[model samples]
Target: MTNEDFTTFPIDAVSQERLAAQGLRLGLVDTSDAAAFDAWLRADLRGFHQGDPSEKVLKEQREGLAYRRTTGVWDETVDEPVVPVATVNSWPANLTVPGGRTVPAWAISSVTVAPTHRRRGVARAMLESELRTAAALGLPLAMLTVSESSIYGRYGFAPAALAADLVIDTKRARWTGPVPGGNVHFIPNERFVDEVAGVHERYRLSSPGELPVWPLRWQQLAGLTGDDEARKRGLRTLRYADEQGETRGVAIFKIDGGDADFTKHTLHLEHLLAETDDAYAALWRFVLEMDLVSEVRAGLRSVDEPLLWQIADFRGVKAEVQEHQYLRVLDVPVTLESRSYFSDGAITLGVTDDLGFATGVWRVEVANGAATVTETTDAPELTLTVNQLSSVLLGGVRPSTLLRASGSPVPDGMDALFASDRTPWLSVWY
Candidate 1:
């Protein structure tokens, strides 16, 4: 660990003092210290209702997570500081926005408050501290993929991207899309984990709301490490190579056939990534046309997935859309300027933020697919809460939808002005 690893947030003081009154110590974890890191890891797992990790797993995770800014609330009064009653961690991630522009984002995750510590304000303290620290660091945005949807709106976060959980009836979905000239081959798990970043990098640039994934998550997806290794023992991975012999796509999946029905096996797709449209069509057809797999289940897919139209029967593809990534805007001007717009227009936007990070009126002008924003005293043609503005920021959720929900007078042309050619999607949870 370097000096950067030892850095602590100044925002911790408020939580520290508040928790101290109740005999709790809120502080950062010295990740280089093995014992402390292990205890925190165990508490985090228990908080999520998972089994205590083995020592081997603990060591592996401690090394993997050493670089993150980890914080926890310790109650030394009970059992004297072995484990914390609450845990949270954060790291910087590049958030891809509309028009292929990327902005630095503070990614928060691994938030947990033990059941025994309910209603103690531990979660509130940690969350507030995180937001304050992120803004202090000069970050323009704060993002998190939520476990419970209802917990974050009060904090000025709204769902900016929608993900689809899909179950395709392979027997009825025939290959109707173009037959791309690419060969699909079975690849080893180790190779896919090492090579996936390149494929994902290409895909992420054009897909708004995608975040840079951690190597640990890639290992989990490739079945390299997990508590349930036995369940992943049968994992199979596939890669697609274009005619020019480049690895353009990958799919990690497994077949479950314990139902005692020989022809009704289910193929579950753990992860699928394709860099090219050709690769996408080929890999999907390979999965849908697999032998003995009557059904396939995949999650965290784009809401506007092309597979929906690739199948012959539209009803064969059953996709359920769910809110995935919730984004909170910290700087309205920075956010509006980073992304490109669809229609050229000028309008005043008024943002109402209780947190006070993004409460202001700004005139947004769009021309030649770029936007320029500046503070203005002009009246707003449309007014939105901080969360509401965040929802439509990426254009995945239409501004008109929220405008209708608010029953507020919004200018008509603003809806088309904020539209995106591609839908926003987060490939994996941070």
Candidate 2:
């Protein structure tokens, strides 16, 4: 969809009206004008405390800006400097749901407001506008990877997926899993875009909370372009192919900090994609057995990765869990009915939403592992805010836990109906 189609913002109308009284205007960036768009980027970088971009970095950023719809909060009272005080951008994409279905989603990112603009309602104004636009586009959900944990809860967003930070002492761990019969080869970094995209497409389909990786991201990850050359130095790319010569897995990583002792080299995994369990095992085994690698570390991995189980001594691996993806429900009935349930039952829920998008009574009925949600006037069996509902929607948090924490009334079998056999996981950052 075009950027213009995603620019409507009815939820922030009240905030805009209030800001106008103070001589500020919240509006879309003039992407058609190159100079105006660059000014917006500079303002955004300043808010994040990043240095001025080099020419190469600016060119790459301009390519990505084409895919996003950007908005800014401008101080119209100033005539000389027209740069905005705050910036936000979003793009439309499909996100995988619990039942192996893809639902319309708004991917929000690049959120920032100048230090001078804080406490003036700039952040709230931009977020409300994005949420309202997503609802108007008939999207069921909006998702983001937050820079801070405490900022988005008041906007009816909650942690919906969890990830793990893994560190493995390669010297202590011994591989015990069946040896995968795949041929692994080193490939040039320039060919990564075409080679890895196919494997990642198959992998992300069955993975919940995954969004399609855009082309610009693939280029950046492969070190074909962008800033951070210091981190990209000595990067290596590996591709795994089966006996039939079909590529099924790929990995990008780098070794650092040997410090004149080859045994002290540390391997950092940047990204790994596998289409099959055998391919997954092969990739991990290859990395674990590499010469002179003292340790391996990766962040934002699935909590249930099989590498921990494949080692002879599980204690060699250490994992720390953290929240990854936060979700906000945009349409109550559709979002509830889209995912499958575990048990056959019925329950009424009264969801309170400050934005009024999902604020209503819903009767969710399930039978034979399918759910049907409809509007109902019956008294709700449970009552909670939209943020609480989002936490439990993916089965990441138990309904009983939320009920006890909030002191809300819970019906008899609500836990059995909402829990999932698999823990919800999301590995992608944005």
What are the candidates' C-alpha RMSDs?
A: 2.1, 2.3
Model 1 TM-score relative to the real fold: 0.96
Tens-digit lDDT string for candidate 2 (395-425): 7778888898888767788888877756777
Q: Give the Å shift of residue 259 in candidate 1.
A: 3.4
Q: Report the C-alpha lDDT of model 1 over 1-430, residue by residue, as the tens digit.
A: 1123224655457767888888878888889999998989998998989898998779778987888899988887666468999999998788888989887788998899888887878888888888878877877889999988988898899999999999988878887998988799998888888668778977798988998887888887887876777766879988899999898988989999738878899999988889899989998999999888899999999899899888899999888889999999998988888898878998898999998999999999999999999999999878889999889888898887888887866677877888887899988987
- Candidate 1 yields a Cα-based lDDT of 0.86
Best-matching candidate per lDDT: 1
TM-score of each: 0.96, 0.93
Minimal lDDT window, size 10, model 2: 1-10
Clashes of 1: 0
Q: Distance from true position, residue 292, model 1, in Å?
A: 0.6
Q: Which residue ranges in model 1 land beyond 4 Å of their true spot?
A: 1-7
